[model samples]
Target: MRTQVAIIGAGPAGLLLGQLLHAAGIDNVILEQRSGDYVLSRIRAGVLESGTVRLLDAVGAGARLHAEGLPHDGFDLLFDGARHRIDLAGLSGKHVTVYGQTEVTRDLMELRAGQGALTVYEAEKVALHDFDGDAPYVTYLDRGEQKRLDCDFIAGCDGYHGVSRASVPSRALKTFERVYPFGWLGLLADVPPVSHELIYAGEERGFALCSMRSNSRSRYYLQCALNERVDDWSDERFWAELRRRLDPATAEALVTGPSLEKSLAPLRSFVAEPMRFGRLFLAGDAAHIVPPTGAKGLNLAASDVHYLSEALREHYAERSSAGIDAYSTRALARVWKAERFSWWLTGLMHHFPDHDGFGGRIQQAERAYLISSPAAMTALAENYVGLPF
Candidate 1:
């Protein structure tokens, strides 16, 4: 097989990149280790920055998103017993849409299919070859048969645990990571959310987030011990625990129901410096990871796709390597800022096992100052809406 770009992974990042490049008249093929259904089954963040939405629109895949996605101008920050609102639009001149990551992937997948794009699912044991020099290619196993694809460039969108980053020699890749002491026990149910917009609540017990997939389907999370097991928490117990951390009014207004899905996710801040390697490039989870506190995971992937797609477009259209040469530096600049924000938010909102009385007071003072000062609120709002791409 031959193509201009051989894309690894069929997740949102890879699919979106293919769509963007195909729209630019670039020939590309996507390969995935899992079935298409498995990709959509993986539940993920639902918040969308304006820039991400624009990218979907560029590829003619935003019709369903704009029609069904919820738009929010602000969210509430709850600390102590009170909830203070931050006007995201007023502060940053931008707002985010509440659309599930699954839906976004579905839209992109369906759009690609309609355009007759080739995506090989269940292409197992995929590996990159000759990415350090010109004439890069990919090899994979299909139904126990070995196959090879030759391409001008290889895109490693397979994710942090996938073969993409692991393909790079350890000496050539520098990694920085911080595994948080706690995890998020999340539950998705058919109940309406306690509030119209998201609520980030910090309590003496722990942190709890009130979010939703839509007006009718609520998604909630509670800060949990890293050693906690998902099987140990029942729906009733999860709802009760979430209610305890919320303010009285919110707790009273909260609706309870059986969970559609339950899972535990450990929080972490990770980055691999210099996202490009010769003809190979890493986008999305292959490059960096942020805690869910800031809702930057999927959005960061979108931004990476944006930068990479633009560079590839420039490379093909103008016969210039300027954008390609600068891709890593540009993507990393915004990435580190997001990493800082997610780390800060996670620290401020969660209870720590080692935090003494003085440390607790410091966190309280920080949250108080954030709500009391317009400058602090504006800063939070700007980061929440997203930094410029």
Candidate 2:
């Protein structure tokens, strides 16, 4: 097989990159190790930055998102039984949309299929070959037969565990990592959201987030020990903790249903420098990952591919590799800023055993400062709503 770009992984990054390039009259192929159904149904990020929404709309991928996605002008920061609203629109002149990543993937996959883009699913032995040569190739097992795909460039949109990053020389890659002492026990319940806006509650019990995937389905998470096990948490215990953390004075209308899904995601921040080497480039989780506290995971991945697509377009049109060469530095500038914001939000909201009363007071004071100070609030709003791509 021959193409201009061989993309590994059919996640948002790889799939979107192919779509964008295809729109620009570029030829590309996508490879995935999982079935299309599995890729479209994976439980992932749920919040979309305003910039992400605009990008989707511009690319004509927001038809269903515009109709089904929920828009929130602000979010609630709860402490000591009181709620403070950070008016996102007032602070940044923009708002966020609550739509699951699965929906985005499904929409993109449908769009890709309509456009007749080639996507191989459940392909095995996916490996990058001759990435440093003039013609890069991706080899995999399709239908129990070995196949080699040749392309001018390769994109590693696969997750952190994929072979895209491993193809790089170990000595040339610089990795930075920080693993938190806690994780989040996330649950998806078939219930209506308690509040219209996302609620970040910091209580004496723990940290809880009230977010929605749709009008009829809600998603919530609670801070827990890093070593926590899903088998250890029961449905009753989960709901009780959620209630204690999101304790509201007034009895709001809420319908509790069985948790359809439950899992624990360990909090961590990881970044690998130089997202490109030779003819191969990395985008999204393949290159970096952030804690979900700031809700920047999916948006960041989309942003990475946006720049990469632009660079590839420039390379094809102007025969200039300048944009592609600077891809890493340009993308990392935003990556580190988000990393700091996610770290700050995670540290401020989550309760740690080592934090004494003094520490608790400090966190409360920080929260107070963020709410009362316009400058701080504006900074938070900018990071939370997302930066321009």
Candidate 3:
């Protein structure tokens, strides 16, 4: 098999990239280790920045998203039983939509199918070859047969634990990472959401987030010990813990139900410098990871793809490498800004294990200042809705 680009992973990042390239008449092939159903079944973040929404629309996959996604102008920051609102749309001239990552992947996959794009699911032991010297190719096993896909370039969109970044020589990779002391014990339920917009609550116990996948699907999370497990949290217990962290009014309005899914996710802020290794480029989780506090994970991936797709388009359309040469710098600049926002937000909301009363007071004071000062609120609002592409 031969193509212009051989993409690893069929997650949102890979699928979105394929859609963009295919829309531009670029031939690319996507390889995934998992079945299509399994890919769509995985639950992930639901927030959509305006830039991401626009990208989906550009690829002709936003019909269902716009029809079903919940749009919000602002979200609330709760501390000491008080609610502080950040007018996201008013402050930044943009707002976010509540649309699941799963839905986005589904949209892209369906679009790919409709467009006759090539996607090989259940490709096993996939590996890249000769990416650094041009004439790159990918090899994998399929149905007991070894297959090779030759391509001009490769995109490593598999994820953090994916092979693309790991394939790079360690000597050339500079990694920066911080693992938070705790994790977010998240639960998804079919209950109606307590509020129309998300709420980030800081409490004496820990941090809690009130977000939703839709009107009838509420997703909640509580800061938990890193060692905690899903088996440790019952539906009733999770709801009770979440209620303890929220304001009294929100807690009173909160609805409870059997959880559809429960999982523990460790918080980490990670970035791999220079996102490019010869003919291979990293996008999304392959290059960086941010704590969910800022809701930047999926949006950041879109931005990376946005930059990458544009560069590839320029290379093919104008016979230029200028955008390709500038891709890493442009993507990394945005990556660091998102990393900073997620880091700051995580620090402000979570209860650190080693934090003294003084540290806790500092966090509260920062939150207080953020809500009181227009400049501070504007900054938060802009980051929340996502900085410009």
Model 1 weakest lDDT span, ten residues long: 363-372
Tens-digit lDDT track for model 3 on 21-57? Answer: 9888889999999999999999899899999999999
- The sequence of per-residue lDDT tens digits that candidate 1 reaches over residues 108-165 is 9999999999999999999899999989999999999999999999999998898999
TM-scores for every candidate against the unseen true structure: 0.99, 0.97, 0.99
Candidates by lDDT, descending order = 1, 3, 2
lDDT for 351 in candidate 1 is 94
TM-score of candidate 3 relative to the true fold: 0.99
CA lDDT of every candidate: 0.94, 0.89, 0.93
Query: Which digits, one per residue and each the tens of the lDDT, describe model 2 over residues 179-223?
Result: 988889999988998888888888888889988999989998999
